[model samples]
Target chain A: MTEKEIQVREKQEVQQAGEPTKPERYFVPPVDIYETDEDVTVLADMPGVAKDGVEVRLEDDTLTIKGTKGGNGGEGERVLLREFESGHYLRRFTIAEIIDQAKIEATMVDGVLTLKLPKVEPAKPRKIVVQGG
Target chain B: MAIIRFTDRPLFRNPWADFERMRREFDALFQGLTGEYPRQVGGTVYPALNISEDADHLYVRAEIPGVKAADLDISVEGDTLTISGERATGPAEQRFSYHRREIECGRFSRAITLPTRVNPDQVGAGFVNGVLTIILPKAETAKPRKIEIKTQ
Candidate 1:
């Protein structure tokens, strides 16, 4: 998939990392979070961000999702109207359960980011069976 | 006399831009006393766009997240161009209930009249990252013609 494609290109841009002189506009991407039988799923709309432009990080109990979308609008194109602002996507959420961080998986399709965070099995309720009395 | 006015506009204008303007005025004039709840008029909820034109083509770019080319329908009739599409809500088989919901999802439609005639067949569109771009080339006859000077 294109997911790996982004990682390969990411290697080239690593040396140039850090804050730039001009600060960019950062906006929160809308998200829908749900908890299933064994996992929690997060779906966020982060249009314009490519696979390489997205970042998901977990530290302590906080989970952060960041995405950057590069736009090369045809030069000299005058804007006749404006509706939405184009910028970076940044969002953070605190986890309530002990999540299996190693088991987390994320995918970017079109402009949507689908994240699966599996809960630690030990955290789920388990029933013990009694032998013959 | 034609006078140009400028101000902050809503997110999206309805198909009828003229009426959307009128509705905004009415919404302001009537204030909040009406029986129904007051709401901003003709504002787009997600992915705003911009339209621009040069001599050859009209350029349009919309910031739509997760919009697939197949999920969109674009057409041009007369001077108006329309774009409509749906944003999929992701896998439908999640058995768990939604803990929190904030992103808006549904079919969206918007149409705008161009400033000049364009050749529909020559139009080109591209979707990158999540932005949708459309280049509508001007019609052959509509393009300005330059007359060459004759030598003395």
Candidate 2:
């Protein structure tokens, strides 16, 4: 075999190795995190997401937020200027020990999903009372 | 005989000043009314508002989606505050083939006249996510004060 043929064979192997076996499309929702004394709020911009269309599920140690876009049953030929197309979003976050799994609350309003996670009572600071000696 | 379409104008009218006064009243009523959000955008309408109190500081929050930090313009004058930004749709050819478009793309300006005077020297603005939050501290005299009560 010629040296050029060996080089071509090596290049083919490298290209095959780089290609993913089962490619999965992932969507990352833009999130804004804010912390106050009471709890930490996470506001995620999930446009075109409806309450019934969204699926918030927790499995094992991963929390997933999935949703379908444009479910309003409006079908027509219309011109679109700018598009924000997020199809079947599936975002998973590894659950941390600091998060209160049982008390997690999620609400969807105006295509914005807000998740309120209250910290555990033991994790919060408590004011100590001083007694007069 | 030819029939002419009768265009009946007002028989009697008030003077120019009286008409101006009525127009002002109508304008005030329209200005006080709450405006409805544009239905084309899928998200909620975040109106840029500047709020101030006689006793405390002021805080302003503006809803600007699909707008980057570079597109914002904020200015303050005395108690008047203004926020202007543009949400461009980019090149026309690039946007012509979009499948679904929900976000609004255009120029938006919101001007608010604060109820109470604020300290112009201490004004701060920050943008996070798509919300623009502006903090304005109150002047020394405008802040809340506690007066001592004497017991005789």
Worst 10 residues of 2 chain B by lDDT: B36-45
Candidate 2 residues lying further than 4 Å off, grouped into runs, are A1-133, B1-55, B91-96
Across B12-47, the per-residue lDDT of candidate 1 in tens digits comes to: 756786885687568645644542223333434333
Best lDDT goes to which candidate? Answer: 1
* Quality of candidate 2 docking, DockQ: 0.01
Q: Is the docking of candidate 1 incorrect, acceptable, medium or high quality?
A: acceptable
Q: Which residue pairs clash in candidate 2?
A: none
TM-score of chain A of each: 0.75, 0.57
> What is candidate 2's lDDT per residue for B1-152, written digit by digit as tens?
97755665355644585776687567546643533111233322234232323235566644454467687888889888887766654334332333223334566665667656778888888765454667778777777789899999
Best by DockQ: 1
lDDT of 2 at A123: 52
